[model samples]
Target: MKLTRPLLILLAIVVLAGGYFYFADSSDDSGQSNLLVSVKEGPLLVTIHASGELQAKRSEKIKGPDGLRSVGLYRVTIEDLIPEGTVVKEGDYVASLDKTELDEKIKESQTEIDKIETQLDQIRIDTAIEMRGLRDQLINLKFSLEDKKLSMELSKYEPQAIQKQAQLDMEKSEREYAQLENKLILTREKSIAKVGEIDASYRQQEHKLNRLLGFQKKMTIMAPKDGMVIYIRNWNGKRGPGSQISGWDATVAELPDLSEMMTMAYINEVDISKVMPGQNARITVDAFPGKEFQGLVVTKANIGEQIRNYDTKVFEVIVILQEQDSLLRPAMTTGISITVDSIGTCLQIPLEAIQSDSLSFVFKKTRTGFIKQEVVTGPSTDIDISIALGLSKNDMVSLNAPSHADDLEFVYLDQDEKRQMIQELENALTRRIKAQQVIARSVKQENLQSKDTGGSTFIIF
Candidate 1:
């Protein structure tokens, strides 16, 4: 048994056969799958998907100015979210503050006014009493002067000495009368001036107090124009506007006109250069579907703001809607796609179809498998990439291909081997069919005008 060459040869043959079968099966399982596609001539649109918000084209926020007095002691509670899309008219009561505190303020001011009035009345009375005393003194002095004059006349007939004494007495009486008259006149003028000063002071104080009181009375918030109410959310872990009296950081509410709407979006700095004013855009709101609103780029921010962990700077862009709807509200989140550039009837391919290292190529499906064909590519939009060379109209190509094929050793299949490749071919055929369907559907669905440049059928497996 140890020296049997026949037995050794038989074992050797069995091992060889087993090895061949094992290799064959393994190759079959690891073979590339087929991808099917039909190349059709059509227009491709490149779009940039940007998220933004639906907003009024012209909207103003009516905010309560800081330090506006409250109407009552009861504070305003701004908890309710106004019903969405409710139309309002001018002078409508959007929100109101309690008036109790304002009332108390008014009363206090009134009390102050009353106190000033009382002081003024007392001053006037004192001036009148002084004036009356001056008048009585003047009358007594006049009567004494008249008696002295009469005495002088009678003494003139008696003696020259008596006449002289009478004359001196009359002179003293006349001087007294004149002094009393001057004093009365001066007292009356002083009294009148005092009363005028008091009255002027009271009026000034009253005017100032009244103005303040009037402002307090207007503390009841009212809408300046017809619009819808939108409540702004508070940020930085703080309550929304009108939450506290911590000195005037309140957002109370906003009245936004429904007729005008605009979408505000932030675009990354890398792509901001592609955006400009007057570019057409399509907008979709999360609240609505199958409804696309038309808009135009109205503004592009010159500056950038950091966003996310990448700290990428983004520029703000505003898109104005052509038509406004009642459903449109301020700050509603929206998805906006700005058409930075659109080429009608341009040759394009799916972004996934192109593979690049130092050069780019697309996989052209064949009966056996896929063959790599080099392509000259052009600018890429969000979805499709422009193919400038090495591809013709209606040239069928694979959407996605394996990345490691460049490193694999090339293998050529004979007729028999190719016949055995039915499974792979069928899979490729199925994929090609689906790809064709997709292309056709896309053309019809997108209303794309397509023309066949070449006769090439794509098989996706």
Candidate 2:
């Protein structure tokens, strides 16, 4: 064994040749195996992906000041707000509104009130001076009447003509005095009416100003009870800093009860048909990665709507979480995988192995080469498709079209056999539909009961 140098050199060349041939042969077999994949037997899931947002099942609405319209304010902007999901006690400051517009209104109202007060004072002064002048005229008229009466008496002892003139003068003075007395009474009544009118205007302006002042205090909203703040959503967007609140819809935010929660998702119209109540789902919170929770579809929209910047229509779907967690927060984004259908242990294959034109078929491997196999297919995912019939666990199929596969022979099920397989598939689908119907009925009943029990459900988008 410890022999000559020539013998050792010959052994080295032989060993190198053997390794190169063995590796070459092994690689050829490995490539062949990679092309031919076996029919797998296991569970296959056909799922749909949708994004969701966490929401509370029940919540109390926090509103801006009531009777905003009564103060002539059409709208107000939220100037400041605490970050959403912040916990606080009752009567805590939650948000503040921009009072600049309201303050301007108050200033205008006060100015009007001042104008009314000035008018009132002017009326009082003018009335006092006019009444004094009228009274002085009445007193002078009375003195003239007395003098006319004495003149008439003196004339009585003179000529008849002079006596007649004195009687006329006395009569004239008496009539003048009576007319002045009536005019004085009317003037006093007019002055009282003017004062009342101006005073009424002053009171009205003062009342308006007072209401504006009171409303200004309420512009600072407070939490009605103890809970975390969740902003209310509207067409414009969620109620937050710089968002406008209309007089009619003054809701600012919400205090949600986190004991019960749900995830709201919008499903594309294409995938909506597969979604229904009672179907199970897996939900993952975007905020908390690597954690998943179980859920069930509780509600689906009857109609579809156009979303902003979306190319296709989407239907709203509501899924209720089965468990509660302390880290769950409202409005948190989540990833939802709704399991629309689940097949039990069955034969499955890669989708690439399957090809179709007028009929669905696969290129299955045979003793000599590959052949076209017409298969009855079932539910499928993006990567794999389930075989309802025509393939089994022992079969092998090509992942890609084999070279010169057209020259190969085809193995197809006869019409009767194909129809029978389709019939079986129909029956299974019918069973699943009936089962879903039963689940739907139960979900409906639960919804009705929840309504009777007064549970709230709302979504922003």
Candidate 3:
């Protein structure tokens, strides 16, 4: 079994040749998998992606009064939306609470007031009649006194017998006249006192009735400012009842300034420390695509708290938009990207360029073929990753390449398909634009008609 030295050497040579061929073939397959991409110069932006909402910069969320007495039996119903962007004047009826019960109360109070007024008038008439009788009695008393005096004088000039009889007659007449005078004076004083008491009572009742009427007026809810009406629902999610209910703190409606707005965002504790006042942000709403609004971080919460689904503590952040849009409204969901840090004119690449396991690499197009070049990367955002080293501007790299494609046929067909998809998308966009224009025109015509009918109309763009 032991071979000669020359034979052993020959065998080793054959094995080595076979091993080389296998290695070369494997290397070729690996090389074919490499992707080709292109690099370009652009501004690099680093942002933190956070889902937020589009809210008024200074919204007033009105809550109904907390006590049971403040709520009436009648429930308020929303007859209309008040057209989101309509301008309102002061003291306008933003929304109405059902005032049937309150209105009835007012009528009842008014009736009582009227009845009291009539009783007061009757009291005055009675007093006037009593005064007239007193006046007549006083006149008779004065005449009796004068007649007695005259008789006494005549008796003094006549004989003694006639003097005694005249004196008795004068005394009797004097007593009768004094009694009449005292009775008349007492009756007049009593009548005067009764009139004063009745007047005070009537005034007190009038004040009480007036206060009740005023309280009833509170049921007719009126707008505090010139703004749009927004309905408020309870935490339980019920809006309003069909009929008036006695005990619910449901906020029927509110008026808010449509021009001004602010956004509220919750930052988790991990990222809260990086957030600060005056930070720049970009706001995007789900309802509006291809549109971004400029916003500034106006506030950062000093404390953290837990809410609904999030287990970690969250700090509130308020963002103010530079301009107000008609489409923006309270509670409209939005996505906010806070620019934590950004460097201008920095070299960057798509986030997909970086591979997993903290290793970053890009395919560099060289004279021979696309080669895998190792790269050093820094912080990465959702869209782009910062290139720290190993990549220069104007380098051509592959976006996505098939490593297993033996020929260019597959690549050509893929490119054609991509173009067709893009064309379809463009056609769809054109149709959407046309449809939107038709809707816009219809809205415009409706607004004009509303104006002619002396009502308000709102159009959101």
Candidate 4:
């Protein structure tokens, strides 16, 4: 029994130690296996795809009333219009501006003119009454002066005291008469000046009223030239009924010369370097599936601008269609594929499989386990890297740093091969910079701000 007890205790200790080691090794290997991913080999075609809309290559603006801002209105609503796509000739009615605001303003101006007229009449009457009163007072003074003069003469035959009093009264009357004459002259001049001031105000108000009346007549817009009417577009949508036209953006509609059409596309700064003038493009209209149109890249902007709702800056790219189709129309959304460049059948792998500092390497699988295998990389996209050297299609790479990867030695290339690979990468980067500069100079000549490039989606293969 003693022998059996000791033997059983030792056996239990051995079994427990074995199980502990087994679980510890299993957990380590499981972690390493999870980080491993296989290398892939295939053709790498880098195609830049962008979304855009069709716009008229050239169009004549069908404008709202000229000088809306001059008439004290910054914006006015389109109250009525002939349906879009209607053919019309010069001098035919196209649209009518809403007269509600204009009518209110006209009413205010007319009221002001009438008020000035009334004020002018009141001044004239008041001046007449005042002048009549002044003249009567002057006449009374004149008669008093004559009587006082006669009295002084008659008193000369009476007493000396009576003559002196009569003389004093006559002088006082003469001074009063002279002062009254001077006052009449000044009053007449003042009345004329007051009337002139009021008359000037009245004339100004009359001119304003006249202008408003003339503008009212022009509120009914007429076509300036002969063509089919196409409603103008804004941030919201096509400017139709109820859309407000402003003095700054006074355009109401357009007469598009539909003989030609072009697409306005927005390409991100990352891919703009790949695009240039005369590059072939394939465009598909969203309104119709399976129908395709061929176009050429006519322009590519060098500078980037902000697009609504996108976080990245994008450059404008213009694509001109080669042929006109009956189904083609303005403002149609299109999908554009511009073949920028392609790398033929080559090896590629997920970008996450590679890591770098001063040197680039991968956690490559080996017969023993995993090792840090130094690799030479080619051009890369946002998500994948092309393999130039140090890995094969059959080889597997770790997506993340495997367990103890920091301690593993790298399977590096020879010094000569490594130096050559570094030279190649530096040259590629230099070439890319020069190409981008060329694209910038080519498309920087024109300002294509008239078209709105929004709601864009992008893809690169």
Best by lDDT: 2
Measured by C-alpha RMSD in angstroms, how accurate is candidate 3? 16.8
Global lDDT of each model?
Answer: 0.63, 0.83, 0.60, 0.79
Model 2: per-residue lDDT, tens digit, 1-461? 56778898999989888744533222222245326678999998888988978988777778899899999888999999999889989999999999999999999999998889889989999989998998999899888999999999888789999999999999998898899889889989999999999888888889899899999899999999999998876435577999988787787888888998888888999999998788999999999999999998988888999977668999988888999999998889999999888878788998888888788999876655567899999889878999988888968787777666677678888889889989988898889878987887675433221211123343221
Clashing pairs in 4: none
Q: What is the lDDT of residue 50 in candidate 4?
A: 89
lDDT of 2: 0.83
* TM-score to native of every candidate shown: 0.60, 0.82, 0.48, 0.69
What overall lDDT, based on C-alpha atoms, would model 4 receive against the true structure? Answer: 0.79
Model 2 backbone overlap count: 0
Alpha-carbon deviation at 331 in model 2, angstroms? 2.2
* lDDT string, candidate 3, 1-461, tens digits: 45688798999999898754533233233655344344655666667667775544333433332342532333443333344444567666544455555566557667766877777788778878876887787688678768877888977989998999888887887787778778777877887787677777678667756654665555455556666655443224434334232344335554555576666678999887766555678988888887799987766668898866678888877776777788877667788988765555557777776654334466555544455665656556777776656678866555554363233221122445445655654664466446534543443211211111122333222
Q: Lowest summed-lDDT stretch of 10 residues in model 2?
A: 445-454
Q: Report the error of model 3 at residue 445, Å.
A: 44
Query: Over the stretch 27-91, how does candidate 4's per-residue lDDT look in tens digits?
Result: 24545443555678776655588898887777778777778888789999999989988989999
Off by over 4 Å in 4: 1-45, 158-161, 268-281, 288-327, 339-377, 380-415, 418-422, 425-429, 432-436, 439-461
- Model 3: residue 307 alpha-carbon error in angstroms: 4.3
